[model samples]
Target: RLERLGARFEAASPLGNGQCSAPHPLTVTALADGVALEPAATLNCRAAEALARWTTEVQVAAQKEFGESLKSLALGGTYVCRGQNHDTDAKLSEHSFANAIDVMAYGFTKRASLKVTAAPDGTPEAAFLASARTGACTFFRTVLGPGSDAAHGNHLHLDLRERNAGHRLCQ
Candidate 1:
């Protein structure tokens, strides 16, 4: 199913530390219909699946908003052993378990790449970004982007962090 969605990847060595781990990780190189992931990403299957699904929606939004196809994604990071928000004292981040990704920007086939930051309120980029962020909530349990907080001011933080009662956090 993931292959049909255009996700190109290979099995990766398991990731682990005393505090965090992912038993079966994968290195994802591309997503939905050839959209590349710059520098690729190491993720657990569930997180990779969510990213593929969300990318499919973002591809459609790009065509509708700019009449162009998405080319690549500038990823900040995927799997890392770190605490939430990089605060060592905080709880372990989803990234620690290869369950999260930070998207820094989106590249298009023709239009200039769009960074995940605050854009002019009425611009096409802003609208497209808004649509992309909102659509991510359908696939990811947690979606944090610009204006969510100081820690997430410049990138979209997406994760499959489960919560009580199936609650979702879309900030």
Candidate 2:
């Protein structure tokens, strides 16, 4: 599906903790003439389903905001980290169950990382990050941005937290 749309895909780290079937979202980038998918740990059934929904929404939002200019997605893949915003005790995060995807970073260089949330002033990175935030609210339940805390400074936290649980945070 991605290739047909000129998307590039790559498999990244796989689960090693011997937990579930290596559940985590495959980080992807869909551009105007090419797409990139960095396959990460592994995604559980629920998260996988949620990602599908999120992907669709992201595409529409990018086009709506950029107009035929599919913003370059640069954040390779979701990191399967031990939970906790910041702490060694950050045990298996929701991502361990493939319930979360950390958008480490994105690329608006070819375009413009909109000014929103952390940026708001229209810095290049900020603008790109903004589009992700602006468009993805409906796809994933929890969206955490830079001001969300030190742990999330460089990434957009997107999680499939059902029941509207946890912090519906946007930093």
Candidate 3:
């Protein structure tokens, strides 16, 4: 499926540290049509698939909002062994299992890049970001970004954390 989406990636070594693990991990460098993931991303296949699917929506939103194609994604992180929100006593984060991605910014083919910070109201960047965040809920079980919390104010935190009764958290 990833190949069908034109995503360039390769299988990675199994990852784990007792508390967190990914049996089948992947390192993705690009999405559809050469849309790069800046610095690439290390993720479980399920998370990578969700990202691949969401990129289509992002491309559409970019075209509609800025009349430009997406060039690259400035990613903040993919897999990290840490507690949620960096609190040592909190539950382990989806990133701890290679099942989450932090997106820091969006790069365009013909427009200035837009960071995932608060954009002015009514601006194209704001609308584009809103569209991206909302669209992500369709693919990711958890979609957190600016306004969700101070910890997530500068990046979109997407994850595939399962929940009771198929509930989703899109904040």
Report the number of clashing residue pairs per model.
Answer: 0, 23, 0
What TM-score goes with each of the models?
Answer: 0.98, 0.61, 0.98
Worst 10 residues of 3 by lDDT: 16-25
**Model 3 lDDT per residue over 32-99, tens place:** 96899998999999999999999999999999999989999999999999999999999999999999
Pairwise TM-score winner, candidates 2 and 3: 3
Model 1: weakest 10-residue lDDT segment is 1-10
Question: What is the lDDT, from 0 to 100, of the residue 93 in candidate 1?
Answer: 98
Question: For model 3, what is the error of residue 68's alpha carbon versus the real structure, in angstroms, after optimal superposition?
Answer: 0.8
lDDT of 2 by residue, 40-99 (tens): 324554554455555555656556555544444445235454555645565556765657
Task: List where candidate 1 sits over 4 angstroms from the true fold.
Answer: none
Each prediction's whole-model lDDT (CA): 0.95, 0.53, 0.96
lDDT (Cα, tens digit) per residue for candidate 1, span 1-171: 779878999999988898899999999999977899998999999999999999999999999999999999999999999999999999999999999999999999887899999999999999999999999999999999999999999999999999999999999
